[model samples]
Target chain A: MASFIDFRNPPGSDRRADNAVRATAEPRWVRRTLIGIVLGFFALFLFLPLAVVFQGALAKGSGVLIQAFTDHDILHSVQMTLVVALIAVPANTAFGIAAAWAVTRYRFTGRALLMALIDLPLWVSPVIGGLIYVLLYGRRGYFGPWLSAHDIRIIFALPGMVMATTFVTFPFVARSLIPLMQAQGVEEEEAALTLGAGGFQILRRITLPKIRWGLFYGVILCNARAMGEFGAVSVVSAKISGKTNTMPLEIERLYNDYLFPQAFAVAAALALLALLTLVLKTLTEFENARQLEASRRVTLETTIEPPSAA
Target chain B: MAHKKHVLPGFGISLGWSVTWVSLLVILPLAALAGKTAAGGWHHFWETVTDPEVVATYRVSFGISLIAALINGIFGFLAAWIFVRYEFPGRRLLEAATDLPFALPTAVAGIALTALYSPNEWIGKWLEPHGIKVAFAPLGVLIAMIFIGFPFVVRAVQPVIADLSADVEEAAACLGASRWQTIRRVILPPLLPAILTGVIMSYGRAVGEYGSIVFISGNIPFQTEITPLMIVQKLEQYDYTGAAALGFTMLAASLVIVLIGNRLQAWGNRFRKHA
Candidate 1:
């Protein structure tokens, strides 16, 4: 408790003493009003709508909610969403780590361009992301005739859905990993190499452990997006009830059918998933902060020691 | 020269895989879209893009996006200020809540917002008596834009606020500057760049937003209709050329915004260094 207070209000410092005074200096009514305004803004804009989703879902009954989930078509949509996410997340994880490794571990030409290319998906509209697949593989598209000649389906099918999800989520894991790995530098891996470790051995024993938290966070984000993706997946999906519709698409379909309870119930399920992602996100943020502090300390010590030795 | 080589092995393999994967997934698809547009000839593309309905979408999308981003800029900054400055109950929860929009599916956000703002719904029921229509109106589109774009501003500004030392503020206070003057002359100058970047990014995102706005906007042509929705409508109608043209236009606009934002951010960094 003493150490904790010291951390918050460090001793023997003018700045800390100033902060201690400022913390309580704000007028009480002013603080209360500000808090009320912020709370009201969040409550109306965010919390109320989230509450409405649950309230609407359960307005009918628990039995109807169960039926909604078990319906043949909705079940298929849920499964399809799972399958796409399952495929996309792991693939992007590999791509992310590889990209992070390349860019951070080596000095290469076009590295900046590669970084910008990874961020391209962020700029492109999700609808355009889906449309790109259609332009490539739709019946009227460039590869359409060739694909049809071979009796292979791409667009408006499962493969196309997977492709679009991958495109939209391409940057997530890579974006997360790049900063972490770049901060770690290549010194540790070089040390392991000098110790006669093989490449796979070095990666497993040295690199992977260092990046595990970042990798985990990336997968969490990538999976959330893969499961939640609507626009790109919708464009590529044929929207056939049991065949191609993902969870988000099915929610729209059910709502359009005026099946309000069922629609919100499924949305409630996704809301739970979003909540889960939030929990994982907050935990990873804590871990990442700790890791950053540790790494910064190590870098500081190394820099100082090297200078003194020289 | 020899020391310039990477210490680790398999640089070639990793780089090869990353470039190949990105090319096949991201670069190729975008190229395909652009290629298809080019193959259709410039006249047809121009005609599709400049169609009056398409032009109306341009106006509605960019106009609402700009207005919504501006609102978010102010409110998001205020919210960030509350988070940074105050030690209140539920502060952590509210901070996490700010990320709700980002974590929630856009589709889910759309329907939920619609449900709340529909004429007979909770808030909407109260507003309807006063002659305000939120759901299925242009107002609803603006709301969705604000919902999705709020996080960009908060996340962008929070770090800068946190990095700012309180000692500086105290120094200004000791120098006999009034609170308002200190905020204007000492505080706002450094924060202006971050706020601008946040607003620009939020605008870019709002302009491209589709899934959330789709359920709320009522999809009315010449009113709530947005460019992305129109592109989807064209796709549904099997007008791939029209869809491509619309998508291309949005993509080009977003790219220009991002490029300009990057330049501005670099300039901001330089300004900070000089300051």
Candidate 2:
């Protein structure tokens, strides 16, 4: 994620040198018009809706916002969302780390296939994510009869929500780490191993430290999506008021019931969560850029010798 | 590569864990959907997915997604180019804002969009006198798709734009090429692939989008309903086979799109290398 839209100029590319080539640049009016159009698009589509979330939330005043939060059902929904995130994030993080290691650190057959499979969830719709679970656990599902006989509930329960959330967020950590790890190469881990460090030691001291920023970026993204997941969870949650509804589901319920202020207020809270995710994501990206620069400098200093003047 | 020995000790363990985890969480559930759909005979599956109402959703979903993706392709290119080439006040802020759609929950986006365009809200009120309806209409569905699919193109093309050195344009200019000529002959050639990939990606996402569209579109059957909503509606009616059939159809469509996307990306890389 951080690797995709790196805003900085790439190393060895000097913008100052490029700026000297003014003859190739667009005219003042052309450049200004493009910028204006882009900014206008952003203002109308992106910023306006975001502003409306808060404005609608505060339409009746902060007191209404506070009262909305204090509602019993809303509070329960918040707790349900947190609980789901707590379970899903760690589970997916562990899986992501393992998957990234296997895919990046070793040569293997079907490696490309494995990567595509890991990325499968991203291509699948979130609603399908939940629907699959229901097909496997609902009353008429494959194991539904046996599970019912044993008195175990999966769908319309916490476990179902967690599975749906986990499925949707499955790719974030591994996808983030894969490119970074591939770029870093396996030589460092090999070197650590040759020095008599054990497997865990090498991973703990070298690979983990090397990929921490990417890891954090992945976890942040996964956590945000997990907490805010709606479509998949909604499919399985059955929208039981105080029992199964997550924050996003609760917002939908309130909005559908014409409780506009409450719906917007709940949305405002999630919006804050989204804002926090952006801040953390930006910070991780900055750290990742710094790390890349440092590594590039190290490789340049050590690996490349300056040519002697002929 | 296969002959080389791995220095890592836990390759087997890591690979095993990865396969097991993915199998349990993703593959097994998907197989269940497949098995359920397969259990229903070909006739049943065909009838479920090809029902008139379901077919209308496909039209709405695919039609609107294509339009939205086309719109994003143009604006997303401009945004990516502006981010890479120009620096202005609030530029960084806007760059961050571009990602808000990705981070913000689709449900929140859905409601916020609904509020903003509900005929009495700020933006909606202005358009109301013109008799232009957005909310509860197919146009509203288009808006939701556009909002959710906006970032794909920008993110896809930004790096490609940055990687394109200004030296190429400078050389073209030195050869007496006009600005438009240089852009058409040199710039747009390589970007065509990236832009296509981006558009296809956005289209894929928009086709499967559920949360954002459900609110704004009001889920009116045969009018503004989407495919995913149809699947949910089937599930609610205890039409498990029907839901599975729709899901299977979408899954197959998305798979085909993914394959196409991969081919385009590879072709794009090859073009860039040779150029």
**Could you tell me the lDDT of residue A267 within candidate 2?**
96
Model 1 chain A lDDT-worst window of ten? A1-10
Candidate 1 regions exceeding 4 Å error are: A1-28, A302-310, B1-3
The residue pairs found clashing in candidate 2 are none
Candidate 1 lDDT over B35-137, as tens digits, reads 8888778999999988888888887789999999999888887788778767778989999889888889989998999999999998999999999999999
TM-score of chain B of 2: 0.97
CAPRI level of candidate 2: medium
Best by lDDT: 2
Candidate 2 Cα outliers beyond 4 Å, as residue runs: A1-22, A304-310
Q: How well is each residue in A84-128 modelled by candidate 1, as lDDT tens digits?
A: 999999999999988999999887779999999999888778999
Q: What DockQ would you assign to candidate 2? A: 0.60
What's model 2's overall lDDT? 0.88
